[model samples]
Target: MRIGVLALQGAVTEHIASIEKTGAQGLPIKRVEELDGVDGLIIPGGESTTIGKLMRKYGFIEAIRAFADQGKPIFGTCAGMIVLAKRIAGDEAGHLELMDITVARNAFGRQRESFECDLEIKGIADPVRAVFIRAPLIEEVGPDIEVLTLYKDEIVTARQGHLLACSFHPELTDDYRLHQYFADMVEDSMTANL
Candidate 1:
């Protein structure tokens, strides 16, 4: 299976490294056409507005939506999570508006406030290491959304069908289980379509 890391911004190399650990081909997707070669896509953390602008400027908005429309899995980390959200807190315009969730940008405060923790993610056997850096928080989720991990009772990880999102940067750590989980999702989607 091949997985793509949206290479427009943020931790792209780290994400690619993690995905490769899952025994899948990891490719950096810098153009809309690259989406066609991957089974799943990972949008890494960065400035959401900037990423949104770039995605739109490069004609990736429609292409990625179409890719998701095919029921292929997508994983969004940190700022990428904000991009995937249908609603952003404080009435900010949403980007992809794909995942059925509301996000509060930089809900964790400033860069100095960034921290790391081991979280008990749902469906994962043990705690997974997570790094929260000026991260966003999932304020609410739609009925179809499954809350995966909560830190201090605040939603940090969630899943809605083929879409998965997390407020923390999982690729920053050596733990590849979360990436492995997403790889399984991509693998499953490929199987179901067969």
Candidate 2:
């Protein structure tokens, strides 16, 4: 299986490495055309506004929305999760707005407050290592969205259809279960389409 990491910004190489550990070919998706070859996509953590602006500049906004419409899996981490949300806490509009959720940017304070923890995500058997650095939080979720994991009673990981979102940086850790779960989601979508 081939997965594409949106290389517009953020942890492109790290996400690629994580995908590789899942036994999937990880391609760097710098252009809209790159979406065609991959069965799944990852939007890694970074500055949300900058990523959105760059995506608009490079014509990735609509293309990514189209890609999601195809029923393929797309995983968003940290600021990427902010990008996927339909609404952001503040007045700023969302980027892709693909997922049915609202996000609060920098909910976990600033970089000085960055920390790590082990989370009990629903599908994964063991606790997953999670790193939070200027992370966003899922403030609200639509009825169809499934809450996957919570941190201190706040929503952190949630999934809606083929879209999966996490408020923390899963790629920064050595755990590959999240990537594997996404890969499996992609494979399932492909098989069902076939």
Candidate 3:
């Protein structure tokens, strides 16, 4: 299946590499029309505000929302997670609110505070090494959301319906399990359609 990665900014190349590793066709989506044929989308880690602005400027906000509304799988990481959150507690400038969670931006402080840690993700058998760079913290997940991974007592990864969000960057690591998981979801979706 073809998977599109939001190429507005941030770790786009890494995510593209991960998608390719998963044996899925990787498409860098900059314009709205590029999203048309993808089976799933990945909103990679980046500056949320800038990405949001670019998304709006390029008319991708509505297109992405419409895609998610159609039950297509979406995996958002870091700032992407912020954009997907339903509410951003500390954000003065509004970001795209897509998921049913409340997030606090830069909860881990500045770039110096950025660190890596082992995460016990719900479905993964081994501890996943998560990379957090100026990451946000998920403060509250709505009843519909399922918490997936945590770090130092804070929620960092969660899934609700077809939307999966994480404050850490799994694409930075060599592990492709998470990407494979999302790919599995995409496969399931395609099979269901058939």
lDDT of each: 0.97, 0.95, 0.88
Q: Per-residue CA lDDT of candidate 2, range 25-95, in tens?
A: 99999999989999999999999999999999999999999999999999999999999999999767889
- TM-scores of all models? 0.99, 0.99, 0.96
lDDT of 1 by residue, 51-149 (tens): 999999999999999999999999999999999999999999999999999999999999999999999999999999999999999999999999999
Superposition error at 36 for model 3 (Å): 0.7
lDDT of 3 by residue, 72-151 (tens): 89999999998888898965655657798999999999999999988899988998888999999999988999999878
Decoy 2 TM-score against native: 0.99
Off by over 4 Å in 1: none
Q: After superposition on all CA atoms, how large is the RMSD of candidate 1?
A: 0.5
Of candidate 2, the 10-residue stretch with the lowest lDDT total is: 89-98
Q: How many times do residue backbones clash in model 2?
A: 0
Backbone clashes for every candidate come to 0, 0, 0
